[model samples]
Target chain A: MNLLKEVFMKYGYFPGCSQTGSAKEYDISLRKVIEKLGVSFDEIEDWSCCGATSAHVTNHKLSTALAMRNIMLAEQQGMENIIAPCAACYNRLIMSQFEIANHSGIRKETEELLSASFQKDVKVFNVLELFLNIGIDKIIENRKRELNDLKVACYYGCLLVRPSGLTKFDDAEQPESMEKIAEATGAKTIDWNYKVECCGAAHSIARRDIVVDLSKKILDDAKYHGANVMIVACPMCHTNLDMRQRVMKRTYPEHEDFPVLYITELIGLALGMDEKELGIDLHFIDFNYKDLVPENSGVG
Target chain B: MSVNTLKETNKLLASFVPPASFTDEEQEPLNTSVQLHRHNIADEISERTFQDVSLCYQCGKCSSGCPVRYYMDIAPNKVVRLIQLGFYEEALKSSTPWLCAGCQTCSARCPKEFDLAKFMDAVREIAIEKGIEVKEKNILKFHKAFLDQIKSHGRSYEAGLVAEYKMKTLDLLQDVDSAPGMYLKGKLAILPHNIKDRKGVKSIFKKTSGK
Candidate 1:
């Protein structure tokens, strides 16, 4: 029927650690939206954490093994393309694939360690890239209700842009696909300095003081630029901005909370899905969605 | 080494960052797009990771506790500084990456939230790809043994890991004293444990394979 529908689309989706536990909104909304696009996502069963920052540091083989294990699972499922919503997850996954592929001996070694040889053929796409592949025109055509002049800021954090070779999606310094996707859904996008800045990711757990300061800058920049919502593709960024705001307020006592929405939730809303269906209420930073919802809604 | 010598070495290492042009002919150019695209490795550091590096202020916080700094020909802080200065060649070549213990002490204490360990790992990946000979053989041997454990178990098994490691290094007899300690401390067992997610792990391995 549609390009998205006609493609017989099927892919493996690696939700990473944050999406499974913390960013429940992104995990729920992403599945629903992709389903709406007539795509089927087969999540790799028993996927382990991608080792994030710590594994790579402590041990190279371990870090690569962490990522390589996931890739191996995806390949076994015969799904060549994977949609990874987390930026860090995407970068590490893609980086591991390339590193293993270029080094034959390492690949052999990894094969021995994991009990499987990776094909290195799998492609990992972040949410934006997946949506781009699904065609913005199709999403726009599918939209029944237009976003009501909602001013949103697209936050890339760092993983999505840098290590551009791994992402191969957008500019490292300032990525606009998230913004473009927002615009395609009929919403206004804002230009902010903190677009590609760090969100003090893992530091949120071990070092709150630093994350608080970094989050303050990002939230303050978004609010200062007159953005009503900050749209992000990273679960960690969402957690820091959306969930960690209370801590930030307690620590700083000066900053106010700004709602952070995953890109999929915004797209689902703009595509006429219900708010509850997108798990909007799960966010820590409260936003009055009634004000944002139109007179008639599909997602009640 | 004494505290004073450590500090003296730290100072010498601090100047190692902003690495001078490659002194060795064996050193390969670190940042080429073809290599980056061919392998899909990020050619440049992410500004976020870089911002963490910028926080160092060249304080040597990471260098002081680094266990291998004494043995290392380069300093950990200087490695961070070098990457900060975009002298990736020297940074990648330095033995710092393989030396990381994966302890988050430096990452935890980083005044700027910089992850020196993660940066080293990234550089290590690049180095391995360039086939730049590692300064030491144990790192390479360890990598091989670790992977071998995974291949047999569909996940890592500590006993399998140690055994394969000992075999690959051809030094099974060398760590004999640790054998009694490993068994006594419940660190090693006569048999390896079966991996929990064999099928799933197998599937994961299949997808990321190059061919």
Candidate 2:
């Protein structure tokens, strides 16, 4: 019996803009994976966008206000912890929480504007955070299938661990939280740098050239370390690394079909969940698990 | 730093590619009028965010550790020094701030705890506000397109942003090759998603943008 089955049963969910729009596959796989883990979610109703990289880059006030709306909305729903899947959304929400709680000026200004009291008690967790706490024992116990053959490069991709103050749940320089989570899903983890490197998140839209160059370096490092698949927590990283792998061809000509999967989708596969149920076919890169996940591993 | 780390840094530095106009900046004089302009700009930066650039000492820690430094017009530490010495125009006009991926590598490794990434952001913001012709135009264009999309719809519309960006920049065929694959993978959603408190969102933007 898995201890997490009862211990981690329910959570408040906040799927950011991309979860509904561009990266629907993350939402689908995340839901299925969590359900199999016996975890239920009370999603915040009518949640707005988290004012991601765009808001913070241009207007700090607007960025905090947008995140404040969601925090207040979740508190209204009587939830203390929210499971936001997108890395950009998680970064904004968590950092905003840190700001409002510590700085009285920002807090007072935001509260008056939102017409809701700011509470420092409310906690925001990205899916990676939750998985880090979900322990390897339970993960191993729940595995119905094993990803024995696939060498995965766990890409933390800038948001999961950075800035050294807020959202620094793991080592800011060298994080192993994602590696632990990936290993629990029976995937072989590789040893390579470029874990917390930026994938040119919002720059994916305007400056594909920059993103292509940055992401190519990351992919080349992963490939050099003998990784066939790269696992990422951020949807933006997936969009840049996996979807834009073709664009990176000019830099790395010999690069092959590299699938960038959300950590939740990999967890779902380990739990013997179906591909369609997890929206596996929705990847821009052709990702067939059978090609990577070998049958009769004899280890599982 | 340890011996191994110093050796590693030297190896990385050996492969460093300086920008095209690196020697020109050294040749150009930081005249009295330019110094005054820079001083005023530094005061504005401090007044805006209360982040003191004078506290920064030239350790070169930020520069050595910066991943994108190879592609930068000036080193990250030098940008801080440029601000301290009152060279605001040089720092702003450089491709360094625009190319910053905001990965926080420099911030994480800063000995004096100065945020190099945030400083770059402030520099970029001032550049945009001043209507300075950026070294990286498409980078500026992309940021403008998203803000334009968000001001209209409460959130980013992927298709709308791409279309608007392409139309504005007239780089229609830039990444056109990737669109068909994106649509097929359900990565490109056509409909714009609006939240219920959109008016509230608009008010926030209105106040911030001062429109």
Candidate 3:
């Protein structure tokens, strides 16, 4: 915990909705590792939804207002940078920041709606962006253990890449940041066709069949590509792929069970934390760590 | 024109059709590419739409990544390019925007990073503005059915979405014969209701739509 305070002293955090509910493993493990690294996540006061896909669909003005509300809070809290772990939330928040900053009329209008004036004071970061910015050398220096022998596929869904100018952390068509993080953990990263394909975000709720089909394709391709585990940095993507695996198996009998993990969880496992501590127990898909991990590894 | 004398009508019609060049006694000569300007709809363009279209780079990435591109009359990329060129009426008439599933894939994969999905959405927005109804029957039925389901349940229920989708696209019900057996096996559920945030959902809809 002392180490986390040191690392997170300057970090302001935003967990978004999915991180609280479905992908809580990301929260648990992320906190665990960052705590060890002395990073503190001073959450903003009275944060609201980043207006995911719904607000954007209904009205552009409302979507900008929704994102501006949280950014205003972050700015008021005196934190210029906030880490939004979920890709969808990050995309929405950053995209809104870019829009609100560039357009004077939009900034004026949204500020009026929120009953507050706006300035371009706050910026959003996806978790990978923070990791990259903090420098991989720092993380590598802190590695207590290695995760050698795990064949991992780094899956980045829609939000991370779309509207590339806003979330300019990596290339949209071919992102290598996740793979770099995986390699830093000493895991073998696999290349696959559907790496950036949609896992059907909110479509999972309104369109289950489509989500199932999309997930089945993702899981099957990952397995066929020889990946033992799929790693995600998005909570919504993790929830749809992990929590809905049973439904997917039932819908498509050919799909075999495969574990979906948050990148933080893998980092925890590599750091020699117990499987249960990383929240791997919450996962629906069964995995045998002994076979996937090196014999000397401490994923107990 | 009588059917027996249809050849004369065909010849007359052929004369009306412009050749490589046309000469008129009173009209001025038009330049090459003038045909394109004749069909342009700049005056009918919506300024709000232009704001969205100006972001487009004519990147074919949206077309390449689109899932329903095969079924679309205009590819998603072409639709945005068309909008940028001020072919507003032609773009509105195209089936591309109406066919989008709001997947975010095109918006996700765009190299120039244009929100083709949002532009497609703006097409719907402008369509409603112009009071031009959705001409595609399947898409219309889909909107109606999903709205009916949400109107009933306050949130979209999966079973309801599926049932509505199936009803709207009659071919889906035929697949239903094989579906219920899977449903019986716990793969599907008949009743659909909001799982959580029940009242909050109604408030959300109301707040956004002014319902």
TM-score of each: 0.63, 0.87, 0.71
Tens digit per residue, CA lDDT, model 1, A58-104:
34666677787788888888877898888878878887888787777
- Per-residue accuracy of model 3 over A1-300 as CA lDDT, tens digit each: 957645445678887755554565688888887666546688766555666665565356656776677788788788877889888788888777877777787777777666677654776888888778666666677787767668898999878876665667788779899999888877899999888887766655435566677778888899989999999988778867886787876787877788888888887776667778887776667655665755565663
* Model 3 regions lying over 4 Å from their true place: A1-9, A291-300, B1-46, B49-61, B68-74, B78-114, B127-211
**Chain A only, candidate 2, TM-score:** 0.93
Interface DockQ of each model: 0.06, 0.42, 0.12
**What CAPRI grade goes to candidate 3?**
incorrect
lDDT tens digits, residues B81-186, model 1? 6655555555666776665544334654566666665667667766765666676556656655544554455434445655766676676664354345435533
Local lDDT at B83 for model 3: 56
Steric clash count of candidate 1: 32
CAPRI band for model 1: incorrect
- Tell me the interface RMSD of every candidate, in Å: 11.5, 1.8, 6.7
Better of 1 and 2 by TM-score: 2
